[model samples]
Target: MPGDSRAATNAATVLRTVLEHGPVARGGIAGLCGLSPAAVSRQTTALLRGGLLRELPGPADGVGRPRIPLDLHTGAVGGPVAAGLHIGVPSSTFSLVDLRGRLLARRAFPHEGRPPAGLSGEIAVGLGRFLAEFDSGRPLLGVGAALGGWIRPDEGTVVHHPVLRWRHKPLGAELSAVLGLPVRVDNHARAVARAEILFGRPEARGSLVHLFIGNVVDAAFGIEGTVHQGPGSAAGDVAHLPVPGSAAPCACGRTGCLQATASDTALGAEAVRRGIVPDPSVPLLVDAAATGDPRADRLLRERARAVGRAAALLLDVFNPALMVVTELSSVLDEGYLEEIRTAATALSHVCDDPRRIVIPHAGPAVLPEAAATVLLSRVFRDPCRSDERARSHPSV
Candidate 1:
């Protein structure tokens, strides 16, 4: 490997080791990451100076200062924080998270009839106000924006967002220009997959598939801790994937497509049509189900089954170590998640263990944490570059 690349790898290894085993000594990081003591020392010094790591009080057992524990700088005052923006059809969620991907604060900006032409600017204004209210004098790293559709993260562009009517828009640069901070953008499905690998279960790093069910339904695949972004970074489009036993008509004139059958938009519209909710809103439907509405419950179960059948197809193809389903009802209620797992296990020929299909580790906060991980993931991959970016953009 080249000198710079080797150094970056070593730095990431040390940083991740500390993230997994916090309040640990440098010797422990070296042992865990298989790095030499000198390399660990070098990276730790850089990390500490860059405000990524902080030294904790050493043991009272009379151990020398060399045993001083180190951990991610998650202090309430001066620790670094990344802003998260998740743009959905109905609303956009803004969040602030620590280095460990823990959400600190979050606010929802409902579009509510806002025109899509300049919605990005409106979201940026709302996000700026949210940050101002929750600033806490911390070192703001930047913003990580995640949304649906074909997003080109390399160029920070939204290749296409059907619901939002965005086409080849430079979302990152636009958000950065308005917010006065660096912004990184990616498909929300891939953002959730990367978040799972970085902060969720250990099995996710080995291999995982994340299925996002929302206004848009999509899937992301990861292997060996790397999320795959195929040609044009348009890998996770499961909108048109056929779902078993679903006869819902899609906009493309196709019947039984996954998004048409299982997405929140479809489910909400169906709920409204069935008189289960007043409007096309999944949250209202879920609330009705929680309030002992049998009609709502049955509708949700039906959608869950469709999602499970679609998951089965992905499982049969990838057979990943884990399948993470991000759905509102499932994340909030275990009974719904069980319905999905049972249906998926029954349909998947390769996966008999229902335990393999689960909700995101962040549960209800999945989108918020996943959106922030869009930037935190980059920081973990190359701390040197992250530090450089932070130094270059100090006003955030």
Candidate 2:
């Protein structure tokens, strides 16, 4: 209920702890968090009264004791309390997710045009529409905008972006004001890395590089379960890594860049070069690949090689513990995918640990949902310092 600071902090921690690792014993939670059993009981009682957590129906293990394993009342915390947004150049997405990261209701729509505010405006509007459409009355603890470009968390601005055209914009502040919710903004790639750390693999907590492949190409670094957001926040802009022999041109006017060599759009452009304007659609490309179209096969394999080369380059420099490559889920063959693994394994120290290089299957959910992971992380990590700043400032 309407508690003060100390109570709030304790309550939040207890709730967060249970949400993170549930079906857990109350005494066990107290011991793990270094809180007294009484303190744990008080917080649990408060949370139970608030309907944020509940005890599952069951008896204790072993002989005749009882252990009503406590859990986040999934019907409540799992149904609401957090919402995620994935913003992009062409479209934006929104979702209501529980503590376990289950999607309750979600919406996707095309951006009308490139607004002066870039994603700031579209995300605000799209989220409003999504909430109204779904009639989701859940408290929106945060709004996370995941998008491309160079985002500097230290400065709280999108330093520069070719895709979003957002430069030095106070994206986090602007949207928080409009949506009336604390917000967390991060690079799409970093979000993918966070997703892997929190949901994908606990081992990825150590040093790792998240090489994300999709309609766009980029990479992010993770250490000790945290994405290495750079001095400003421009850590994963591998798309601009210069390619010595790129045949395709980049949107940034660069003659040779990784994105120019490997992005799906880059592959589709090859069809035009061959004098065939394939219709613009993801399903169309997938259909071609399933039907064994030689051109699609060649494009996919060549693109996989470019991705492999990028991984090798990063491994040479970062020497990360692992590399998780995110790509389209429909991709079932490793025709040249092995070339990437072979390159990472042979050129770097990844051979000893086969888990070093892995491909994470992704679909429309990869880029955007990854963006939301940063928001969820803030609550679990530290109540979101940036979101706290958003709450304090109220305006940029």
Task: Evaluate all candidate structures by whole-model CA lDDT and list the values in order.
Answer: 0.93, 0.67
lDDT (Cα, tens digit) per residue for candidate 1, span 146-257: 9999999988999999888899999998999899887999999999999999999999999999999999998999999999999999898999999999999999999999
RMSD of 1: 2.4
The candidate maximizing TM-score is 1
TM-score between candidate 1 and the true structure: 0.97
In terms of lDDT, model 2 sits at: 0.67
What's the CA error at residue 335 for candidate 2, in Å? 6.3
TM-score, per-candidate, Cα-based? 0.97, 0.80
**Candidate 1 Cα errors over 4 Å, as ranges:** 61-63, 387-396
Instruction: Residues 1-396, candidate 2: write the lDDT tens digits.
Output: 335456667776777678667877787678667778888888778777755667776664553212457887666533345667776555677776665565666777677665655456766877877766765555566766666678775554677766666678888778777877777777778887877776665567777888866556778998886688766666788887865445567778877788888766666666557533455443455557668777765666666666767777787777777787876522354544565676556555434454577764333455555666767766556432235564577652
lDDT of 2 at 351: 46
Query: lDDT score, residue 285, model 2?
Result: 57
C-alpha displacement of 170 in model 1, angstroms? 0.3
Off by over 4 Å in 2: 1-20, 30-52, 58-67, 76-79, 112-123, 154-156, 243-256, 275-283, 329-339, 349-354, 361-364, 383-396
